[model samples]
Target: MLNLSRLSTSLTKHGAHKIALLIRDHDPDKVLSLLWGKVPGINIEEVQARKNLSAGTTGLTVPSVWKEAKARGSETINALVLIAIIFSHHTLIAAMRQGAKSDFTGRITRDVELDGKAYTNFAHTLEELGYSTKHTQQYVDFDLQRLFKIPDLNSLALTLLALKMKTAGWDGTGDLKQLLIDNGFHEVFATDEDQFEAWLSSGKLTAPSFEDADYFLDAAKDSAPAGKYKFKAGHKTKQTGSVSVKSPLTKKTAQLLHNYIQNKFDEQLVAIHGRDCVGCEVATGLGTSIDVVVETAKLRWFYEIKVGKTLKACIRQAIPQLLEYAYWSAEPVKVDRLVIVAVHKLDKQSETYLQKLRDDFKLPLYYEQFVDA
Candidate 1:
């Protein structure tokens, strides 16, 4: 027996009044009637969505909230705001199960009651307003996790959104950071601009596991910054050897080989694509950085620069690291190629293994050997 009045009051308390008014103004009377039916004793209408632009031949201008969201380059924020307003309940399982049709609907139905008809109507209105089912689900999931006191959802959502924007050629870091702070994710995401960009690029922020969710809650309860909170870092490779002293000549040779190969690759990229190619040291989800990454109009190349005495040694280290980088990316396309840039060519055995991986696993992997003049 949920009190609809208390839920409505909670919505108003959480700065959802403007969005609520927007729904009342634009949506039909039947929709309003359905919403009011939930509360059982409220009868008032004639609220309007806020208008932003000057009136034109196109009709009344879009609302400022949506306009601002569009200006920021993500209409998803607009949809999420509306969702936060209309389905302003403490938990979303009920609303989503009854009102939404998404990948989660089946799962939600099995776990929660199917009585939130009002939410279904609201979800339909959101679709009419041009939000996709996936985006709608993301918003619902975000707010639901927030209500459940999960602290990591904010970072996870922003990170994924940033990735989507970046793949579309938009830098959404600034807008997303501000949004996170505004939505009470300041503690976990109060990182400086550079660090925030690194986090998004690395794809370290992901959907939280049960343990991760609980850890975030603990951090929030303790009022500790996310930086100070330590969770178990993933992708730790098994160490094969101990740190041993190396001769000065050996170390120098390795450094020179690495530098030479990297320079040659850069020159080759510039020659092939000129200004269209961009290269950088991209951070990885494993708390490490890729040696080099080159992006062109058609392909993204991930390089592992290594200079060991034998090709086997270089390939052994590069394979695992490159694989981690490829799978950890949040981009729509996986890494186009996994390349081992080494000082010497692969031997028979190394080449045989590489061929097997390509033929059997369909891994787009190769080795590029460089020679210094």
Candidate 2:
């Protein structure tokens, strides 16, 4: 393995600002091209000579560079995408050497399909053909760190926005778009409307990339109220089979719930050696609007917060809603705990129904009244 610490340190010391600039200006592929081209800005001659010496064994390892790129934050991913805009084989090699994981790298390999037969080892082929990975062993251990957790872009976006707003103090609220732009979204997305529409259309917009970040969007919608970011309540209507109405909990509610869970249970759970879980899919299917899934205690927790006079109807339908969430969690999360946390204005009958669930099914069910305090 190359001396990763030395390489990383050298790259950071001499090339960090340049790499940051590359990310800011060009796509990731372009940045990779600069590296592969041994462009004038960063010293690649030494790196090139090293590759020339080791033509086999551990062909140029690029995963390590991407690990560094991601460490540099969203700016780098943007830079990588920019590189892809004007892609070439050299740039592709640069990207593979820098960001492409083995699996994704294979899909982009052009010459590997020998008469419609794909080659198994593209990275190795690239190495044999005068290409080398700049950062290698450093990233080999990355997969291990991700073994016990789920990744949530919603939480990340909120956290990033919160960090950006801290300078404003509690009184100073900031526009989420501006904050996202300041952080890096502007580079990834050329325009606000385009980005926002992309987000709405794909629902793939995350925090970093702003894809699927229901929590952040809800907060923005609430804070501005007039801005386009406000969280819109999902459609609701009366339904049969144990009365139901659509959940009014917007993305804002999701954020609040995330914080509530983290503040209340994160430390305690971690203390008890919980796996540090994230948003679970307790919904009925991938696209269906069922409910949020929270995994804990080796069981799936179904969560819905209900407000207004519709509490009774929501409570009646809660069982079926939870059952839907339970089925979804089975495959990806594999949770066994069944729980429902409902925040609603309760009636005597609704309170009784809540208890009946806890007592009869031996399930972990809870109810809380809507409180302004």
Candidate 3:
């Protein structure tokens, strides 16, 4: 568990708290409009040509008048505050490494305490709603937008309040760079030219390249070596040689299985053969073909062997073949799930083998029949 108090102080030091303040001060509706690409300010309509007028010229401030009438009754300001805080919370958490241990501890001054109190208050408000600290544990556990039908200002406010507690400083000057340095990344912000560039490109700091270079040169005095190395690699396409594999499943069968996998997961699987399979841990020493490799956000799994052949002998080969594929796959991917999809009409032995593979190896297996007729 992270020390919420200290984390909040760190957050304040890092500008997370100021971000909350920025949101609280700004009008929520205006921010939402900008985010959603809607025009801000009050709506208006034409005075004389009511039917002819659109959101065009020759209009009166009717929307503003109506809004003004409700402004006193409805808590728009409070709602806006909430929304801003929520956005700020998201921004801060996404940017920082959550749950990291602090390298050093500092005195909790009055300003830090204030930020922490505000964060706690916000969290209390949100706890009244549904979103809690528990939701932060998993990556895809919650969809923030679903908390409320509209912009969810209340939830946003609560989220921001919670995040504010994690802010680095009270007025945004808490020495975040020092905090990181103390936390076992001293060399991260080290003034070495190459190190500075690497940290800059690592997406930590938003400083300009020239400023960063100058600062490192003046501070660290370690000039970076000139080189032709770039962070991202380029892709090159080449003409491929023609090749063929002998299997019961023809192009039509492969197409049907491929379509099935795509419809199920909304992604295309890249099927490789020969040497391509050799390097892939999913396919160690397969004769001519490899299974469809499906990669997802959290896990990677394989759907081995397209079912095209009808022969029992051929069908029998698929299980042992798939078992080998699964074994090889586990070696490389350490796959959480190992699944096999085959044509519907299967001999009893194949089904038994599949069950055994699933039970013994703890692989998530799937058996399905295809009908292209």
By TM-score, is 2 or 3 better?
Answer: 2
Q: Per-residue lDDT of 1-373 in model 2, one digit per residue for the tens?
A: 1112221111111222234344445543344455444555554333432221111123343323434445556543333322221121223223334433331121223332211111122233223222223313222111111111113333333333333234223234655544444433333222233333224233333222111234224324222122111112122211222212233233444344433432333233334434444332222443333233444446544454332224554454455445443443335334344444434556788678767877897655566443322
TM-score pick, better of 1 and 3: 1
| Candidate number that wins on lDDT, 1 or 2 | 1
Which prediction has the highest TM-score against the true structure? Answer: 1
The TM-score of predicted model 3 comes to 0.23
How does each model score on TM-score? 0.32, 0.23, 0.23
The sequence of per-residue lDDT tens digits that candidate 1 reaches over residues 1-373 is 1232322212112222234333333432222333333444433321212111111123333334333333333234444344433333423323443443322122222124222543343444444444423333323221222211223333434443343234334445456554433433222222323233323334332222222233334433323222211112112222223222231113344454455556666666556656345353555544445666767557777777776545776687678767756763444236778899876666888889999999999888899876443
Query: Per TM-score, what order, best first?
Result: 1, 2, 3
List the global CA lDDT of all models: 0.43, 0.35, 0.33
> Cα deviation of 344 in candidate 1 (Å)?
1.0
How far out, in Å, is residue 260 in model 3? 11
Q: What is the model-wide C-alpha lDDT for candidate 3?
A: 0.33
Q: For residues 1-373, could you state the per-residue lDDT of candidate 3 as single tens digits?
A: 2232333112222222122222234442232222221333322221211111111233332213213312432343333333333323332232222321222111112223224544443343333333333322112111122222233333323333333433433343454333333343322112323222223233222232221233234444224322221112111222212312232233343344444433332122222222222212223332223344544445555544443334243344345545544453323334555454544566687678767867896756656543322
